[model samples]
Target: MSQYDHPTNRDPSNKTFEPIEHYGVVGNLETCALVSRRGSVDWFPIPHLESSSAFSRLLDGGGGCFAIQPVDPFESTHRYRERTNVLETTFQTEGGTLRLTDFMAPMTDGESEISERTLFRKLDCLEGNVDLRIVFEPRFDFARTEPTLSATTEGVHATGDETPLCCWTTFAAQPFEIDTAASHATATATLTAGQQEWVGVSYGEAVAPTTETCEQALVETVDYWREWSHSCGNQAECVFGGPWHDLAVRSGLVLKLLTHDETGAIAAAPTTSLPEEIGGVRNWDYRFNWIRDAAFTVQALSNLGHTAEAREYLSWFLDLCRTTTPADLQPLYSLHGESGLAEQTLGHLSGYRDSQPVRIGNEAADQRQLDIYGELLLAVFEATRSGITLAETDWQAICEIVDYVTEIWQEPDSGIWEVRSEPLNFVFSKLMCWVALDRAVDLAEQQGFSAPLDRWRRHREEIRTEILDEGLDPTGSYFVRSFEEDDVLDAATLMIPFVGFLPFDDPRVRATIEAVDDRLTSETGLVYRYDGPDGLPGGEGTFLLCSFWLVDALALTGRVEAAETRLEELIGYVNPVGLLAEEVAESTGQQLGNFPQAFSHIGLINSALHVSRAKGMAVPGTELIGIELGTGATVEAVRDHNHSDT
Candidate 1:
């Protein structure tokens, strides 16, 4: 209920809220939010991930919240309604117990009943004897202002002074009285074993709802989530098919909810500024889409065999690609392509545990992270394999990116680590440069696209040789983040085998794995990025995504059992919803950073797919272990498949 305590204690007020990680994600391809173990929705942004928040309590719990926690200290359990948008949270108290089912289904695909609004339908005890309590507290504009709460024919309403935001609530049964002195309302009711109760919260431009009309809306909403869950279809053919395919597919559906379906733009994660290092200045907005994450995300969908989603994202990305040049492309951008995010903090209600300086926007939008060019190219190339035809202008724009990458491939930039400290020419950035040129040649040869084939091929080989000769250690046993550092382990290195930069059998890859174990791992199995100040001073929970990356690499190397053991350990970190955050703190068994991060989910899906495919297992049934990412395929196979524009 409070912000988390800062790890370093440099800023005692910057508390990082250790959110209990149990959330069932359901979305309608517009946006997704995280609902917790105690049945509190700590993280969710209305309208869009990048837009102003509808619920900001996850970042600053004092901001405001509309939670349905058990008032009797009962046993609470939660889950997603099998393949649907419906969320079920059950509370078992001594006086029998109750179930709270939540969902927000979109009205008839293109319906015009409302311009833009979310109807939160909380259904309880349709046929059970239990008492249920409800709290509807409205805090507008990051909990900066207090709204006036009042009763309505529908149920309840709250309006803020400065923001034109109104929240309307409705209940199915005759509920309890209002608690105006608390600036909120509470209702407790006992239902017969076969009776049902409902509560509805509508935000944004709201109109009065008749009791009959409101009840109908709840029914329609349940139908909406069920329909969305069905869209996942037979796993492997979508984007990331096979093994944990259901998990991957479901996560994709959640991503769809966090995305603007019409715009093809996807948010990094639903929550913002949730802190990387507790109480450290590491919190940044993640609602915006990132160019670097695009390829991985598309790759996940492509791997699932979701051709449409893959192509849709690229189409959306290309729209944002009208940059002055490739180098001008920012690492991340808002869903609508707005640039220059300024950072702001809220001083009210205290932070989650008092992690002070609750940030609203990310200021790292314009940093020169050169690796994005390669990532972007990789994404476009994958779209082609999925059967998407690129327009001439699109192809021209892609080539421009390649051209720009050529000019700055040698410069020292912000590296893949995105270190806030001074810039360095990270090995990951240069490696991606190689990927860009390598894929370009393949694309031109297969698609008959106009390209300087010989020049590109030479450059590709040259980059590879330079990496081997200069970027690696003299012994050729390991690779470093930069030419200046020791053999440091990076979660980014899980990418070595993936990008075809090295074979799973390569000694260098093996050494990197061992080096990672020696440096970044905790005795209890958590992993860290590396041992250094990344532009800020403090500590953080181990990076969960990176740990999963290690799991995939172990599988690739044929260490199946070892990989599985690690996979299970990592899975243990997941809250009840099968969702993972950005990092993990071994000492506390608490999830850190943002909730329901896309990268962590991508790792979970990709590794599951690789291990599942390698071991011949499926995702929803058995957790895959010891599967390698880039094994089995020969160098020739990679080259041929990558070059075959078909």
Candidate 2:
């Protein structure tokens, strides 16, 4: 008789959902998988990041999952490999220790093409004997179609539609038992010290990888990430170096992961319908690329020594601009540059943690977000400042965008928050319209691009004057959210200094900061995007991006110590593997909204740069869209100006 006993079947239907923070992400720059701390691959979308999920146990209990874990009781801990997205989870059982290494095969350098669509999981037993259970259950099309599972020569094959899912393993000790009625496959294995097993799940064709090939793929993936990390700005220019350097690097990696290698389009987040407020109706799809988000992402990455990504994104944006008139531009688009993103609710699968109305395809794409004009133009201005040259065609497209901004700068729009309420003349939108003209004039003068300089200048100054007058409340103490809601403050006003709309020490800017700090800040010091109504049914967690904006605002206003303290506190909210979500629950501190949000990571990088510069560290690319990060003279000048005003 065999010494090892049969492992207990841990049914996928009985598996409880993991906390949002209790997961680490791995990607091949195409699609990503969310691996829970308990050794379950719960959320994975095949073919692409925006595709319908194959395993969505993160949302519904009976959706699907592929879990490899000890049958007996065990505790698990996970962390990403240093400077890479490769996740390593260690399971400690009473009998021995098992290590689970997970990663998608990475693409080669200098190319965005993905040649492999595979997820690899390797298990290594370090000591004593351990019995492990493997469960492979895949529900295609968001669990709407149950796949037919059949045992292949290498492992198990699942076919639901045209796209087949293949699972291959090197566990020759036990063959997988396919349960067609249940739509799952199971296998058990026992290993002693130094024994290792490998599993490969391919989204397309099945290719059984041997032990040698798995080890080689692991080495290549690790090398690819380490090489990419070594190429970051901090490696050469030391763009960020301090106690928080590792977190900054991790943020950069997260941004890179969210970026589409083939198209240079950066998804706001990989997954859709992870609620901002649990069990509320605030969830929306974020898989598409937003102009504002991608522009900010470009600036952050370029500052971090990934200028190639910026150039590619600019190319992608220019191409997108070519397809439509500037007057009809949308706020967001698909990864392949498709503009029509009709929102639809997936009523089949339950939302993450029972958040209802799981949605895909963002409707905000149809909303008129005027801030994108400024953001896109500012990205161009920053790229030009970084020595990236724009083609004549690109210049023409930009001029059209700037001209459109001139025509509509006075109009009320959805604004940056994409509120579904009535359109109001948001102060932030006007500020960005000014930014659009300001950068356009600068670009025209510097690059010798032909543009109506006088007209641009007139609109620019008019915008500045209008904002100074109308953007303020009756008390004239600080900026308001909008002209209609003059009594309400917004955290977006913290960017007044960031975009160089006003000096950091400007009295109005100071008052705005103070007002937001007093009102919009949570008890734990996190900033809410706004306390005003947004036509939504429920409230959301505190915005992580806005909190980082506060950090930047503090650093810019000569409060370096306070900025550092706040930043440290915010860093404490990151998960164990150094990943941040879109928001954090104010009461519970639990991560809320989408996991590994690109905007949150962008905020982390920018705030780190600001804090580094405030501490007298010379960061490269600090002159972002005329927002200066000087330490000595800038701080003293702000202080002197404040003193004189007093």
Candidate 3:
């Protein structure tokens, strides 16, 4: 069989590998690394998310990797530190059992500057003697440049051609050697029961961290995370209750990992060019921040009474407006606020699963997606409701976005999914155009600040009328993906009730939800993003985000029992460490696309909120308990409680 015929954690090089779902993630807010179950740091971008990669083994066989694992075959399991991003994995071999903990130290709360670029891993032997191997490789610029590895007084350092990295080990003398043939440094050690060792890597400036310093950093980092998470406020009563509380908090932390601390721009996902389908051209870079996705992220966090994220993004958005051309805004921008991101492909490196055309920048940055106006305005409106008042200048900027949509709402453009096909008058786009006008008017009137109320109201009503009249199927039973195409379904149209274009119980919205679930849902209850041609070759997996949206829709429409059942099944498919990818293949239940996807986690947060609130639980600010979600509560018990009756 061809290598791509099935999923494996190993790269095409036929080395020891784990499947994508077996990896756990750790981040320090600036960047993240994917650590396999067996303890290989397969993917890591140095300095920042969009920076040149230092460990690209997840994408290419010869791409660099830093791995530390037991030399013997072993059984293992992994999990994150409670309410923190730190990951812990345990490997049990016939001779001994060992545990490895991984993390990147984070900046303290209220600190705005980034002064450290360090990642730490600690290994402890809990049982008999165990032999271990450590490999440290530094391949600069996506393995295009090989750094010169030299021994340092403390350990070793790689200099030349990109950011320099310093690595140190706690083993006695920890002898290190440069392996030019493999482009890596190798070390081996043995540990007895109760023995521990620390390994650290620092990018940018060289800092020799002793074993004592590394151990102290671990303690401080754990305390920092626990404190910050506890400050999420009144968790006992909020949308997260019972067994699912930590899962919700973990989702929130994952979203935080994807966000740039100084800029507040949240990436769609950290890695680029992971395919939506194996061996397909559907791979695209998702490291940059999309305005639509970021805005939705702001709204989701705000609903949980977490206003700090919304405040930061609002500041970032205002900064963009001040420097950018007001009349033309692109769909995405670089993390540092740069507006241009030209798409490019790397031919030298093999893609994950052999998916070709590994892309760097996104081409969709140039495409016109009209729905962002509504998404941005709605986020602003939600923030205002939470007592965040925008400056007059910021308010003016919002009006410009709304005004632009009024003139071009009727024009065809790339819809929300960024279909590469011909632009059409997509129903979802028109519906959001209406949302733009609706929220703009609401913000203006509620804040007692604005002009053109009559014009805005009229435009909103007109867009609503147009969508209802032309965007629905001729059968009058459900909404169509686009007015200019054959009657086909899109899971995105489920947002009709989500964005408040219509009430949840509105007959049309209800029918649309039912229609999507019936036709687009897989046997596993995951939703396919869309079924028709999308200007790409090869089939993709079921879109995990859309399935979460269906969960919210069902709960909101008083189908709480069904929603709970679906949600329980959905959560079971999350990665081993309570993380999620952008999509999941129906055939094998293997995770596809980028790992630790922001959209997927955001959907989880929002869907959980809906399920919690529909059952009469308090919104995120109060203490709630006794609901069996995530707590091993039986499905029969969930069926007995009527959410509306509470």
Per-residue alpha-carbon lDDT of candidate 1 for residues 390-477, written as tens digits (9 for 90 to 100): 8888888888888777777888877766788888767888888988887787788878899887888777777777677766656767
lDDT of 2 by residue, 220-309 (tens): 888888877734454435657666678888988899888888898999998888889989989888888999999888777766678888
> Relative to the true structure, how large is the alpha-carbon lDDT of every model?
0.64, 0.82, 0.78
Q: Give the clash count for each candidate.
A: 48, 0, 9
All candidates in order of lDDT, best leading: 2, 3, 1
Give each model a TM-score: 0.87, 0.93, 0.91
Best by lDDT: 2
Report the alpha-carbon TM-score of model 2 versus the true structure: 0.93
Residues 540-584 of candidate 3 have per-residue lDDT tens digits of 999988999899778767787788888888888887688888999
Model 2 alpha-carbon miss at residue 422, Å: 1.1
Model 3: lDDT equals 0.78
Candidate 3: residue 211 Cα off by (Å): 2.2
**For model 3, what is the error of residue 488's alpha carbon versus the real structure, in angstroms, after optimal superposition?**
0.9
lDDT of 2 at 399: 90
